[model samples]
Target chain A: MSTAFDAAEFRKALGAFATGVTIITTKAADGSLIGLTANSFNSVSLNPPLVLWSLAETAASLPVFRAAEHWAVHVLASDQEELSGRFARRGIDKFAGLDIETGVGGVPLLKGCTARFECKNAFQYEGGDHIIFVGQVLNFSRSESAPLVFHGGKYAHATRREAPDAKPRSAALSGSFNEGFLGYLLGRSHFQFFGQIRAQLADQSLSDDDFYLLSTLTLRPLISTSELDAGLAAVLRQPSASRLPALAERGLVAQLAMTAESDVAEYRLTEAGRDTALRLISAAKAVELEILERMGAEDGAILKSLLKRFLGVVDPDASVLWDDPTQVAGKIPGSGWDS
Target chain B: MSTAFDAAEFRKALGAFATGVTIITTKAADGSLIGLTANSFNSVSLNPPLVLWSLAETAASLPVFRAAEHWAVHVLASDQEELSGRFARRGIDKFAGLDIETGVGGVPLLKGCTARFECKNAFQYEGGDHIIFVGQVLNFSRSESAPLVFHGGKYAHATRREAPDAKPRSAALSGSFNEGFLGYLLGRSHFQFFGQIRAQLADQSLSDDDFYLLSTLTLRPLISTSELDAGLAAVLRQPSASRLPALAERGLVAQLAMTAESDVAEYRLTEAGRDTALRLISAAKAVELEILERMGAEDGAILKSLLKRFLGVVDPDASVLWDDPTQVAGKIPGSGWDS
Candidate 1:
């Protein structure tokens, strides 16, 4: 059967079954620590507490595992990718310079895993080029951290899928936007997010555009009109000239002395503006904390990472708004902006 | 060793190791199809292409599987959750009204899965209360579809995590906005998204606020001032009274006849406004397609779903902007808004 099958294709097919990463560890008879990363670990029985993992017959740790009375499986967490890679290497002291705990039969246990299963080696079966070791679980512990996933020869993240019943709402009328629209989602999210901070803005009698201007002012001590326009280009459709005068009149911003670099003139957030911006920002951060709490930390991280990537592709030059205002002059040429 | 361990606790610990869902199927001696969802499936060896899965000894299909000479494992795709659940249940015809393909030894193979392995049952081991059956794979195939993940007793979606080296850029100065900020991410994403369609707005001689007004008109035939204000409140900070007259002067919007129900008149898109908006929307959709293409389809869906969830938490009332204007009056009270 093996002679007829393509080994590479077989391996590729096996990779399709995504598995949580695990570092199986044990102690050699000579008292040396031994471990290797494997995704083949799986639970076999609950009543008798059995779990199993297989190791290549030619592996250096195979002899150690075969002679060991016990071994432990550390289910890697999303943050343990480096540890997974460390144990996967050859001819290296995987446990050197690390904290470890001795489990059943002195098997070294790695910390910060999603789960730790300490087991006594119970049975070994010949599995072609590998040996399958079934273990009787003696003790175990689990954590709430998200598990690290491996699929198609790459690390992945698993997000709790929304319930099937939570379907994307369709628009009542045709040609109207629905929840599925990326633009609608982005716009609505922005507005709703700002909506949380809007109370603070209202207290300060600042509008959405005013909030935008005020926040931009917080990015630097004194930003020239040209710099402000360029930085806020993607956000504000109306020019800063229209909103700045009002903020200045309200004493939220103050004009800076003309500089030798240019006569464009610059504006800085006044003391009151700084205090208001800080207060509003703290409130906004609180809103973010609540929203992220509801969305789960893992999903929230993935969402932000993806949004940054999307922004990278769509608005590569948009980051200039937050970049050092002085460096903006040199970055303008390759900023990928047509203007 | 098992006597002291709680079965439920052990099972909970094992659940921490996420596994892709699989439906194992085999033909009974009577030629009847037998299938059940299992997450115990794992690759055992590469040389002989061996894979293994454990079945509870008490399972009704245990005898059938024990006697089977061949079986198939179907690694499910993310979209196959319902099929997974259907096969997980007992006392029902799991194969009812479905297309099925026969594999080795006349074993039934499920369709639309991430991968499939047809194998010859080669070995069985005593695994406490379960039987671990090892198979020598004779044939297998795989698809690029994202695998269905099972973790902590629920189905999940796996998204390719960005490499750890790709960290978010930190702010140049402390206490300033960077990619880590949700408001910055959302604002940048929205602006950059609209930036793609800004050219169309420019071609139509429309300002950003004009584009917003024109697009809002596309939602309904007749939008009242109050409805428009409420709907676009998070978006447009200025009163609709200021923007409406300007739009009407430009013939992009028109004041409808005042109704007996309310003194406030309604407005709708003019023919030119509708045409411009439709054209701009088509352009925006193209940008969306390009963006989604760059980001894999699965991640794109997950990101949008998460953003929608986040919006649901922060601004539950924001959806009214897209709701039918006629229905707005009745929904205002419970719209999760103070006004």
Candidate 2:
């Protein structure tokens, strides 16, 4: 690292300008495909239908691109991140097993991109250590897939901004616990979502705790008392121990004999229990689908993504709820689970 | 619109490429300052510290930019969308009332951008209906502020893609009700969040329903039973009517005489009730702050944003919780709330 204005610093500064990830592809003179990932792509002019991108002079495919009469730029979708990484790497055949589409001038195009622009190489300009290639669009197509973004040298998810005019509904109670608070929003969203599902639970005379316990049973074939206690640690106000007996009496759950290795009691969902839990789960999922559909796919995906990440921080031990039964042997006597 | 290859369609294709908003500024030869917002900006070379952007050939400031010796590129921060729009418009002084910093060659620099690059005009190229100006970076600085992104002709939020290796912690229980379920995540996050606040509520011996009723009173000076019922409709399992009398018995609430305008009973939080609600709210907020901090500011903001949007879809009448007291007159008899 040099003391004065280093290259890494300059690269970081440039990265502050987020751009869509693009894979620029062309055919080599030897009849082989050529493509490389670049975030340097941008639109230059609309009337003449022009777009431009630059390539490092040191790139291995530079010679092929320089002589190519045309190339295709594929704007990757949010789901195409793996493809971006494949094209960005050095040595392996990038198009292996991929269904490639041949565009103008025999340039190979990748399917499922958010947008594709087939262009005729129109102008090349000197850009120290690189060559800026400007192309006139010959033909193009676009889809509604959410765009993948590159910022600060990392892949990102770009979500549509809320309309500016959609201000907080009211300032009537400026400082009150309104929709602006995260806790209130989460609580409200959770309760509202379950308010609909609770009706389904009522049909079976199951309490919220019973639903939680039954749902946990559905996650694995058999769950021990300790596992249930650990899994519902944050969810149930009381120990799951007290609730299991009632569920067992109701025939929704059945107790199993102690295993050879451990003396703890285990439980499994009976046929009736599995039927009940799945029925309730199916209903819950329907509510989830309706809310998600109303929010639209892109926003719904982002909301779930953020929730998963937030859960990573707030509930580091959340994995307990879905832990594999085979890994139960490794559970220390009282360390991980009891803590 | 044309029969083939229309400009509007081409523009839509180009919009699929997301880009960060940039405001390029420089002093005109005559000493007047000139600036315009452009997303047609990209880094051309790393070793030589080169960047480029383009302007429409028919623009009013093209001539100024073409001959300008120096210009600064300001990568707008997420909070600077207003400034981006200001510089994007035609006519009027865009620099008026701005706290400007003079950069290399006396170019005006705006404050609070994610990144700023001062460069010397090094080359010009013909780009169809636009003029491409390449610049050699002479000085630059960057901050950690999140960048503002423009995608599909709308402003968007760019959130970092989760680590590829951070898969769903377990597929151990495939297709079961587990952490991967959105409903489960929302419920867990909500309960985990409140689990911390319940202790504070327990100090005052308040049930969850009691807290809901008490918090409703905090939103306005006086809340009628109808308003409380409407506000807590989605939250409380039973009607608020059954819960308020208990709170009144606790001296946490005071019943007011029936108002002249309506016959419904109204209630206000007593000093003790207000104090208790605020205290519990403060504790919940501290929990929120801790979780947000643990999740990092960027992800936390994104989470809250998505939750707010999700709430909009699921709870259409959520505004009732924060409605203005004066709007009580508009309550159509047994129509909106009673629904």
Best by the lDDT measure: 2
Q: What is the lDDT of residue A60 in candidate 2?
A: 88
Per-residue alpha-carbon lDDT of candidate 1 for residues A36-103, written as tens digits (9 for 90 to 100)? 99999999987778899999999978888988999999999998999999999988899998899888
Q: Whose DockQ is greatest here? A: 2
In model 2, the runs with Cα more than 4 Å from the true position are A1-4, A224-227, A257-266, A317-319, A325-339, B1-4, B257-265, B317-319, B324-339
Q: Rate the local accuracy (lDDT) of all candidates.
A: 0.82, 0.84
Which candidate achieves the best TM-score against the true structure?
Answer: 2
Error of 2 at A257 (Å): 5.5
- Model 1, residue B49: C-alpha shift (Å): 1.7
- CA shift at A259, candidate 2, in angstroms? 10
- TM-score of the second chain in each model? 0.85, 0.89
Q: In each prediction, how many residue pairs overlap at the backbone (N, C-alpha, C within less than 3 A)? A: 0, 0
